[model samples]
Target: MKKSYRIKKDVEFQKVFKQGASFANRQLVIYYLHKNDQPHFRIGLSVSKKVGNAVERNQIKRYIRQAFTELQCEIKNEYDMIIIARKPVKACNYHEVRRSVEHLLFKTKLLNK
Candidate 1:
């Protein structure tokens, strides 16, 4: 994903957490805030150390980014989103990760149906 499409700042993530609408499933939680000022979607992933060691956390984040990349075109634009992965997510493969992410996005109505 491009830099413009990734939410990179602490403040931005905080804003989403505080003001965005949220949804969740067993594996993931999604928080989204609509931004009429922007023309693209920005996403951030949160995988804590509780999920695993550095390697496992990085792997999960990579899978999430890949999933988000694939789903980007179908996602509604002009939103800032945060995806939080639970510890169980570390056990998931890419396909599982993608499915869980997609499921949460749909539940949140972030993906355009």
Candidate 2:
């Protein structure tokens, strides 16, 4: 098991929900909003019951947290991110999840921008 990227009690999530915009690719839906602080990225994961039961949901969350941790060094700052796991995620592997997140990050200009 891995420790999750702690989603602090900051206003980032609320800002995103109220003002941030979203863009989705084939694998994931990324909702992002810029903040005033220096390069801090908070991640939130959403897995619906339609994806699976408690066991499956937990598995998906673990995988997502792992993926984010793996990319921590490469990710940029000052953005709040929300990743919503779709049904396809349940059938995907860790690498697939990683690649999916990477693609979104790259596409959204969160890296090297």
Candidate 3:
């Protein structure tokens, strides 16, 4: 993911956490806030130590970023989103992560038909 498309600051993440709406499945949780001025969506990812070691966590992050990249056109613009990975995600493959992400976006009404 490009730097411009990512939520990199602590304050930004905190803002989304405090003010955004969220949806989740067993694998991932999504926190999103509408940003009317933004021309496109930005995302932040979080994977805890409990999920796995560094290698596994990085792999999960990569899968999530790839999923977002592929789904960019279908996802709504003007939102800041944060994806939090849960323990179960360590057992999932890329396809499963993509599906989980797509499902959460659909549940949050952020995915366009």
RMSD of each: 0.8, 2.7, 0.5
Error of 2 at 113 (Å): 7.0
Ten consecutive residues with minimal summed lDDT in candidate 3?
1-10
- Give the number of colliding residue pairs in candidate 1: 0
Model 1 lDDT per residue over 1-113, tens place: 89889988999999999998998888888999999999989998888888899999999999999998999889999899999999789778999999998898888788789
Top model number, TM-score: 3
lDDT of candidate 3 at residue 18, scale 0 to 100: 99
- What ranking emerges by lDDT with the best candidate at the front? 3, 1, 2
The pairs that clash in candidate 2 are 39-77, 39-78, 40-78
TM-score of 2: 0.84
lDDT of 2 by residue, 14-107 (tens): 6676797888766578888787775467787777999999999998888888888778877886777888888888888888988888888998
Error of 3 at 72 (Å): 0.6
lDDT of 2 at 34: 80
Please list the residue runs of candidate 1 whose C-alpha ends up more than 4 Å from where it truly belongs after superposition: none
lDDT by residue (1-113, candidate 3, tens digit) is 68899999999999999999998899999999999999999999999999999999999999999999999999999999999999999999999999999999999999988
Ranking by TM-score: 3, 1, 2
Better of 2 and 3 by TM-score: 3
Model 3 clashing-pair count: 0
